[model samples]
Target: MKVIPTACTAALLAGTAMSSVAQGVYDDALRLDPNSYETLTVTVDGEPMAVRRYEAVYVGNPVAMSATQPARSMGPGGSPASADGQELADLLTYQKMAIYVPEASIEDQSTAMIFAVNNAGWFASELRTSVETGGEYVSTSDTDKVGAALGAGYVFVDVGTRGRGIVAADGTAAGKAPAAIVDAKAAIRFLRLNDDVLPGSAERIVITGTSGGGGLSTAVAASGNASDYFPYLAEIGAAGIDADGASSLNDDVFATIAYCPITSLGYADMAYEWLYQAQRDEQLTGVSLEASQTLRSQYPSYLESLGLVLDDGTPLTADNMTDLLMQIVTQEIQDHIDEGGSVPALGEMFEFTSRGQTVEVENTWLSVVDGQIVPFEIQDFLTFVTQTSALKSVPAFDRTANSGNEGVDGENTLFGPAAQEYSNFTPFGWNMNEVAGDGSGADDTGLKWNEFVETKEGQAIAAQVKLTDPQAFLQGNADSAPYWYIRHGMIDRDTSFAVELALYRAVAGTDGVKDVNFTLPWMTPHSGNYDVQEAYGWLASVLSDAE
Candidate 1:
């Protein structure tokens, strides 16, 4: 039998439990107290909307219990408590979650709960603290995005998650790769545990986020209820895990909404190189030509390995990758033209000229053959690409220590382990180190990719990368959400266009995925919620169909 934790555990999970329960006893009471909320006002569409705000609610006991406490007992999921407790207090701070229920429609809740995954560039974030210290419950921009949901009576939940660059008081990395996603899944389980008292249907959860948050959103959507994450969830004492790492309550979501997600980090570096290798300027980009070409060479096999398919069932290959990308770009241009937006003149579009010779308006970026805009020369398109967006350094992510911007690359920090501050998580990074001898301590002679994977350390990093692999999930390796809404801007430049396209294809090609509404907003940057009405409309349609 499970023990219902004392007020101390209740206080933390429900609101503010500070008193100790029993030694060695897990805080298994993960449900929220419905009465422990105060009505607060949030601005939705410039109107003051009343909402019942439940703040700083811990989803589950992430730390292990002390031996002096009560004897350990099984929780709902029945997994044994075993995670380290050294950073328990601090970890709880990042585990807290907030829920906002519209006061007017609490009795008439929407069909689903919307989990607004916070984006701090995948770095350590404190959502509950931000609200406690007088900041808005959610950002104004976020409010704008979710206003439709709030107005429609959906519960808006913002769950705190740990990320890279956070260290515990014990000098251990508190938030690292997979930690944020783990916290996210735990919060979902917590909501499922308390589904009876929650304002909306916990079974139908929709996750929405942008950029790094978008990446995590994809991770959460893809890896739903997969056994791969069970161990991590069990370590955190999340409410729903059994002896066999099975949970009665599932972590699967109904849908996902991601915008400009910098995802698939394992392939991002290679994709970046493959997309922009021709446009890279060695002196301007500060990356060696050899390093760039070496990384570029590895992309073909990686691209083919995904086995991505076009909507018409054509296999996506490196040879035709440019064709698909061009199709997406030309379609976006044609869409803007149809919307009465004028394409920039050749002079304004191209950033550079060939020896002071201005390019012609016709047959440049686009042509008016028979008075209809058609995609012209690939060179013109490539030129516009170089002109519009700046290229990232060679091997965009997982930069090695000697890769000019060492100690500062976010992706390096992301893939690094707790004790280590930075690491090369990608084969491109590793191979580049070997080729350029950039002082990453790689074998100077040569480091074979297959040999690296055979090592224990390589196996560990591969596991970490697998945790964030959407392709693995979408390709029938795990349960993925049926509905997906993804948006990538035309000029984002954060990652290769191939990244988003690959994700789109993965979802669109999957058997069970009901719908995928993907768009490339013209001239948009790496951002989200630009088309809130359309996004919400899509959400409403899907929810309605689900009913």
Candidate 2:
């Protein structure tokens, strides 16, 4: 076995302590060894395989590690964090990666790599725990993709990232918008820098993540080597930079597999109300109802402004959106039944009965006809969503100081820069209190459109918002991923069905996109990795076609 120096410094090799200044200078350059890996046994689709695991490898230059606040300020349930931030930062593993390679594929540099973006929720205080233990080293969840990749002689890389709400001891927000995606990009670049030494093909990388991580995956797929992120990358001394200070290695991937991505934050509230406005009428009263209607009214103009078209060149308008959504719902149900999967019973709104090789949906979005499920009514689908799921408030993503939603939402914190805890990204949400006296206090507490355009802080937030959105980069100069695999559960109320649909339309309509495998699975919740076989099967076909 070839042993490589863990650090380039000679003093470290001689077992001598170095000065802090020298340590900082040496830490600026990160080096990895091709042979420095541990072998582990893992089960992939019921088959045991020998896999090489590399744990907690830093993706960035940790020159000032002791000065970093690695843990988030807020805890799991909104409590104040008690973790040792210095110790976590000193580990130099916050913006890091854990790589896994199949032993059989160790010598194959052409092996496709899966960059799994670790889910860093609104506030990722739990990431410290993940790093302290070995949780981030090997993911127990998404075994289907990771296991399938290793089983197929492919490499899997777990990319850890910074999430919102991490604060410096000086009261500066360390984790904010673009930080998470930037870290993921740096990790990918690190792999590319060592393409010759690593077991995977950097050019054939595929990214996968769920929810917030899914949003990051989408951003990485869209942004690629876009110039918007160069500053952030340089700040961390990310790998793959040439002497001229330009990015020599690309961060773009071959494909993306995102599940229930909670994205398009700037316009998510409007989309949410547009889908569930009718259902909300029964649930909300007074100020909330007015605010809901106000947001709902904002959706059609925004939808039409997008210039999105169907597969057949017809404009996707509010007049025809329900029919299109119903078509998707029917198709999902039919596909599920065809695959011998039964939808769970939903009281009187939906009831399914299966006999031998046929299934029926009674008084729901679909019904069995000649041993096949067919579209019944759009109202039935809406009713299913209404009865099954509880509706969020008027302004969802950017919470207003309304009756129940008094504090800031996660995305609000995400869009804000250092020390700016909460911000309103949308004008409609910010104008609610002023327009309808809804008592949201958004005008007072949230940043309004005028300020967003006029103030420097707001302008910075605007740029960050664009950086986090995939639509801003979908057709930009940077190369978008050629193959796209996106799935959003039809029953998911986390954001809006419209958000994912917009993303699907954008990616599918792009000229460079080779193939788009998009779906809205029936009865699936706000989740991911639901169909590992199907996802991996699609990936296998794409990889084969690439060859």
lDDT of model 1 at position 11: 34
Q: In candidate 1, how many Å is residue 203 off? A: 2.0
The TM-score values for the models, in the order shown, are: 0.81, 0.82
Residue ranges of candidate 1 with Cα displaced over 4 Å: 1-27, 43-48, 63-91, 128-143, 281-287, 349-364, 367-371, 403-405, 431-449
Worst 10 residues of 2 by lDDT: 1-10
Query: lDDT winner among the candidates?
Result: 1
CA lDDT of each prediction against the hidden true structure: 0.67, 0.67
Number of the top-ranking candidate, with TM-score as the measure: 2
**Per-residue lDDT of candidate 2, residues 101-201 (tens digit):** 87889889887998876553444322222112122222223435555666678788866566675554456665677777778788787777678878879
The per-prediction tally of clashing pairs is 9, 0
